[model samples]
Structure formats: C-alpha cells, structure tokens
Target: MDPEVDTTQGGLRIDGRRPLELRRIRLRLGVFSQADGSAYIEQGNTKILATVYGPHQPRGKSVSSMTKATKGIVNCQYSTAVFSFGAGERKKRPRGDRKSIERAQQLKHAMEAIINLELFAKSQMDVFVEVLQVDGSEFCVAVNAATLALIDAGIPIKDYAVGCSITVSDKLLGDDDSGKSTGILDANWVEECSPGVTLSIVALPKVVDETETKSSVILAHGAGQRLHLSQLESLRLRALQGCKDIRTIIDQAVKDHLQIFVVTTALDK
Candidate 1:
C-alpha cells in the first residue's frame, strides 16, 4: 500500500475526492433507437454503454437451457474495447474470454435479482455492456448503466438495483493503530489496486420505511486483500449507503430526462 495512493489517510484521494465521494456520474438513456433499451454512462474516467433486448421468446439453444422453469432468464455479455485501457496499462481481454465471461455472469445475477422474471416466463432478456474506457469501478458503472437500460426498455423491477464498491484501508476506527479498520466508498482504479480489501456490493435502493423492506443487499464480493471479520459490518453498511446514494442520482437523472423527452415529443407533434 503506497502512501501516495491510499485514500483512507483521512485526506483527499489522488483524484481530489474525499474517502466516500463518488466520481461524477453522467448518463443518457435510450441512446440507440434500434435496441429495446440502451444507455451510456461515464463514471469518473470509466465510460460504458449498455443495451437491453428481448423479453421475447427464447430462440437460441444456449439461451433456451438457461431459461428458468417459471421465471424468465437474464443473459449478459460484457466486453471492453481493446483500446479502452490507459497507456501503459495492461491490454484488455478479448470478448468471450474467461474474465469477461465471469463478469457477464455477475452482471446477469444482479439484473435477475430485481427484474420481474415471472412476467416473461419462458423468455429471455439480454443485456450487453461494453466498457468504452476503464479507470476503476468498471463493474459498478456497468451495473448502473445496465439498470438504466433495462428501465429504458420498460422492464418492471421490484426496485432499483444499484452497485457500489468500498475499500478498507489501514486506517483504524478508533484512536489506536490496532483499532478496527475503516472502509471507504466508491473506489477508483488506484484505490482498487492499492493494498487493501475492496468490497463490491449490488443492492436494492435503501428505503427508510422498515415496513417496505424485503432485501437490502443483493450481492457482496470481496477482492484485493483479505479483510478481518470485524470489518465486514462496517464495510457492508458503507457499500449500502453508496448504493442508496447512487440510486438517488439515477432516479433524479431519469426524471429529468423524461421531462425533456416529453417536451421534445410535444414540440414534434
């Protein structure tokens, strides 16, 4: 863990952000007229495009086997452009590579958790995510982008499923050095590569109403380094908060876009 890259030092990070600060997220919905739904997003320097199709009959044999007995299946294909990486960074894997395949499955699982699969039983919904640029938190950005695309495609979901990442650094919770670890939110590539535990979470947008709760967390994945059991709760909380924040941003963006679209259609008519 190079001190130069550690954002958990109770100081601003390398990119001039506080520990819990997220990169600026800019997104547009329905970017492609041909697809059922499509979106483009930029989270920090990571740019991604997502397209959604289907909710139609499962045609291909590969898709047929994956269809659930009663609930429709969600299929995902994830890829990164060959030139998406920064100069001197490692080249990206080709499409259908093992890494891409695994990420595709992960994205698929996140989508399946919120989508009303029973609404289209014996069918399939396909989501495609392309990483146009990579800076960090690519998967989180991709998840958010896919969610927007699904919404643009008019898919009904129980609630918004958002993704966020948290990284626990050497910072201690209390005064002493031996205190419990403190986790930071929305890790960029530098923090992700730093020597620490990075936790990626996919969760439904948190609601204050206790009576309105079903499940808060949909998925939690740990990477980079091993974390102590004591830090898990704090990390989970931080990630969930990030999910809630992201969901708010997305919700506002969608509403703004729809208002603009409504005015544009009115003018055209």
Candidate 2:
C-alpha cells in the first residue's frame, strides 16, 4: 500500500466510491455479425471484446477423440491489444505470451463450469477475448464478456456466471469503531497494485428450489498476496456479494437487449 494511499477517504474510495460499490459497467451483445455470438464490455478503464464461434464439428481427429461423446469442447483464447496498456510502450506479443496462455486456460475452465456441454456433444465452441484496455481485473472482465457472448450464441447454460475482484485492506477498516478486516469490492488499478491481497472470483448464483436455495458455486478464484485462513470466509462472502451485484446488472442488460430487439423487429415488420 502506498503510504499516502488511504483505502477509504471520507467514506468513499480514491475514485469516489463506497467500499462495496462497483465501477460503471457498460456492455453490448451481438456486436459482431460474422461470429456466432459476440459481446463487448467496459468495466471502468478495462475494456474487453469477446466472440464465440461454432457448435460445429471438431477441427481435428485428436480433438474429436478426446472430447467425450456426452460433452462438448470449449476452447478459449485471451489476447491484449498492443495499445491496451496506458503506458506509452507497446507489447511485443499478445496471445502467445505465457500470461495470456494461462488466462486463456482459466477462462476456458470458468466458462465450462456454467455451460451445458452435454447439449452439444462432439461439437466445439471457441471463445476469443481481446482486451482493449486493462486497468485491473482483466480476467474477470473477460469471463463476463464471454458469458454474454455465449448467451447471445444461444448456448445452453445452467445459469449466469458472474465475476468480481476484491481487495483486503486493514487500514480501510481502521476507521470503523470496531476493528475488522475491510474487503473492497471491484478494486481498480490503484487498489489492485497496492500491497493488499487481491482476489478475483467467478461464481454462479441462482435458486434451486422454493425451500432450498443452492449455494453460490464458485467456478474459479485467483488470489494475489498472502491471505490468512481466518479472513478467507469473510472475503469470500464480500466477493460473492460483488458477484451478485454484477449478475443483476448483466441480467438487466440482457433483458434490455431483448426488449430493444423485439421492438426493432416489430417495427421492421
């Protein structure tokens, strides 16, 4: 943590937000005509574009043989534009980099957790995510964008998969009358770069039955900095809340998109 950096300034973050508040999220689905489905999302400074192609035949016999007859294959590629970084310098390479490869794998697993792969057995779905700007939480943003693209593609999914980033800061909670570890939701670049532990989570939140609610299933989680086991549960809860909020926002966007599409089609007729 920067000596001058305060987690909460006048009950607001450095960017003028409450500890639990999220950055402004703007997204659009079906952004690309050629792809089976596509979406673009902007979470504060980080912007990503995701496109999904195919529920078609596997490209090779090796892929076909490996894919179970009851489950489909999910392929993901994560890339960052040369100008993604705000700094003047450009990147030497994007997709082939080691970090990018790991992110691509992570994204694949996250999406696979929610998608109903059994529905399209022996088929393949390719998701490609391109980061236009990266201030923080690039992986989370990519997952969200890919989910929207999958929805646009009309792929079957168990539920919406949402992602959120959390950061823990003791000083942020020091102002409280009762001392407790403070968890900040939707951390930005500055907070992410700070000394505090940053955790990114992707989860699915939905009801199972009237009397019983299914526990929020965490599809993926990545952590930075050492975090104590004692604080893990609280931090997970905070991150879950962030994920719920993001899911609400995304659900509304999907509804809005459908309404607009319906109205446009009616008007055209």
Per residue, candidate 2 scores C-alpha lDDT tens digits across 29-146 of: 9999999999999999899999999898888653747544678889899999998987766878978999999889989888898998878888889999999998888889899999
At residue 200, give the lDDT of candidate 2.
85
Please, what is the whole-model Cα lDDT of each candidate in the order they appear? Answer: 0.82, 0.82
Which candidate leads the pack in TM-score? 2
Residue-wise lDDT of candidate 1 within 75-185, one digit each (tens)?
Answer: 899998888887766554647888799899899989998899888878889999999888878888899999999999999987888999888766312112555556667
Model 1 pairs in collision: none
lDDT (0-100) at residue 11 of candidate 2? 61
Q: What is the C-alpha RMSD of each candidate to the true structure, in Å?
A: 3.2, 2.6
C-alpha TM-score for every candidate? 0.88, 0.90
Backbone-clash count (model 1): 0
